[model samples]
Target: MSGTSVLALRLAGPLQSWGASSRFTRRTTESAPTKSGVIGLLAAAAGIERGDDARLAPLAALRFGVRIDQPGTRIRDFHTAHHAVTGASMPLSERFYLADAVFLAAVEGDHTLLTGLRDALRAPVYAPYLGRRSCPPAGRVDLGLHEGARLHDVLQSMPWQASAWYRRGNRSPQALTVLREAGPGESVQTADVQRDQPVSFNAAHRRHALRTVVTLPVIPGLAAAGGSRDMHDPYAALDAFDAVEALEDERP
Candidate 1:
């Protein structure tokens, strides 16, 4: 009932696409990672294969939270044929634009598993990435754990305000200001974060797969029995889930 959990820090980045059904068209869109895909990534890092996923049942108990940053904007280049036939110069059009976004993922689960994952991250059996191969974490994982706290409470407690960045000593740390929906025709205040400078897209393309890195969060109840994962079919694995009870007064 009492044990430590592993904290896997994923630094998501801009230009990363986690599309579910993008293969049909060359066009891609942004979406959350699928359970199968994420687990597959983990398995690959561990030098495992598809069949090994079920063996990682212990990881199922982890709690996962994705904090999106860098809400990226998409850019597209087109090719056109002039003759409207094969191999002819044609007109090109902007297919679509996708917003660049970053995700900070905290995986809270078994302490031993977390430790193993942390170690694996440092020296991954295979090169690992947040959402794409090009992006890298801005900094090393700032990981920790907490007990007796709900997931929502932990999220709110994190220093989300822009001022906290300087106060927390991340002077040069990249930050973003998020805008939320209040109501129609209503406005919310967001800290106007100035763009630091023009990023060298060429250099980013050459050195990395993505433009920026992602920030992660505190994962609670990672090491408890079962696992702490955001598995889509969590109800199917209830026995292994953390024993945290949903309170009547708790708001979703």
Candidate 2:
């Protein structure tokens, strides 16, 4: 309750990876974007270099929530490299990613800070990637800065950012799912604790703490479908041909 502003970001990309528990030989991605990754992106936009713990602290403190408009398919790639020390072949590694994913992320904090972040995203100091350097954002990243908004409110209010194809296929156009980082004193029935709280970004002393997150079901008040009409029956012609053939067979 320090301030009433939330910075919204559109995290849509061709390929994105938000690693939660990556090991030496395996880099896995979470099904949805992680707070660690999104905070890192904000830090980058604000021109905070890696390992700058002092500057990252405030950004990491902001409340985070994500709306999974499109939880794109998971994809993996195999990689092999030589060890730097021994010059020997290293163990094959598998890197995971989400393809054609779209997410609406919100960071609720002080009005001044959130406004600054929105401006920084519009004209970033360093190019911000989705989660890794190689996976760049496909569309505009800055959604806008909303004053008098809270974490849950922003997540629920933001319009759905699903892909055109995905939206067209939806049976109900007036629904979207939101997953939020549980805050203090919130009545959470079920929540998953994730170790994504950033302590220090120092490579040698990097650390994280556990954070509680809960999933909220679809919120109402979505805009009506637009000009893009849903596709007609996919098997209409085939079904008609099959009926004609059945009728001819019965005539014999």
lDDT of each: 0.39, 0.80
Cα displacement (Å) at residue 242, model 1: 53
lDDT string, candidate 2, 76-109, tens digits:
9998999799999989999999997888888888
What residue runs in model 2 are displaced by over 4 Å at the alpha carbon? 83-88, 171-174, 224-252
Over the stretch 98-146, how does candidate 1's per-residue lDDT look in tens digits? 3334443455555666666666655667765544454433334334454
lDDT of 1 at 200: 18
Candidate 1's TM-score reads 0.46
Q: What is the model-wide C-alpha lDDT for candidate 1?
A: 0.39
Candidate 2: deviation at residue 181, Å?
A: 1.8
Worst 10 residues of 2 by lDDT: 224-233
Shift in Å, residue 209, candidate 1: 28
lDDT of 1 at 224: 22
- Model 1 spans > 4 angstroms off: 1-10, 31-37, 77-100, 134-150, 161-252
